[model samples]
Target: MIFVETQYDQTPAALNDLVENAALAALKHQSAPENATVTIVLTDDEQMHSLNLDYLGVDAPTDVLSFPSEEIDPETGDPYLGDILISVPRAANQAESTGHDVESEAQLLTVHGILHLMGHDHAEPEEKERMWQAQAEILTKLGLGNIQVRES
Candidate 1:
């Protein structure tokens, strides 16, 4: 199952579909289990800053953060992938600078987060290449071929 929540009041109503579709595309590309579950949260920079500081010891706000989990829901027996939190205001700013809309930016972030949850990382040169290739392929399949992930 895929769940989406928005803590910002200015978020669009279509955000749910955007997140779900992006997540589904990533999961399908990765060949994730049929019953895999994940959650996507759209929040503010303040919350992101706090999470970054607390969890990653980074005192700055980031565009997206993924917390990977390996737990299973006893009742449903679904594998809980983890939670993805995105700072909506940051995404808006990135979109403006990247010459794309916030919706497209959010979708890109969604795919990036899902890839992280699936153990794809860009920490090393080879790992980054593989992850970026997979991300590009997934984005292309989602009709977002032009949207590129900015290097941080």
Candidate 2:
């Protein structure tokens, strides 16, 4: 199951569908177990700033943050994939700058976060290429083929 909680009303109605589709795509791409779940939190820049500072020690708000959990929940036995936090404000700005709607930007972030949960990282050159390729393919399948993956 995929859980979506929005602290901001600006989130698009398609948020839940996009998240669930992206999660399924990620799991399929990674050959991960299907008994998995993820939580997506849509929030404003203030909350994002606090979370970024608290977790990553970065004082500024970020587009997305992924907290990957260890596989297999002891209680439910599900492959708990952990949480994904998206800053709606940041995504809006990026969408405007990129000439896309906020929903597409949010979808892109969701895919990126899912890749992270699957252990994809862009910290290294080769890793960035692989991760971006996987993200592009997934986004294309999600009908967001033109969405640009922002470099961090």
Residue pair clashes in candidate 1: none
TM-score of each candidate?
0.98, 0.93
* Model 1 stretches with alpha carbons more than 4 Å out: none
Per-residue CA lDDT of model 2 for 1-152, tens digit only, reads: 78888898877787767776777877688777778888989899999899999999999999999999987878989989889999988988998999998888888888899899889999999999999999989888888888877695
Best by TM-score: 1
In candidate 2, stretches whose alpha carbon ends up further than 4 angstroms from where it belongs are: none
- Clashes by residue pair, model 2: none
- Local distance difference test, per candidate? 0.93, 0.87
Which window of 10 residues has the lowest lDDT sum in candidate 1?
143-152
Clashes of 1: 0
lDDT of 1 by residue, 1-152 (tens): 89998898988888879989999999999999989999999999999999999999999999999999999999999999999999999999999999999999999999999999999999999999988999899999989999986664
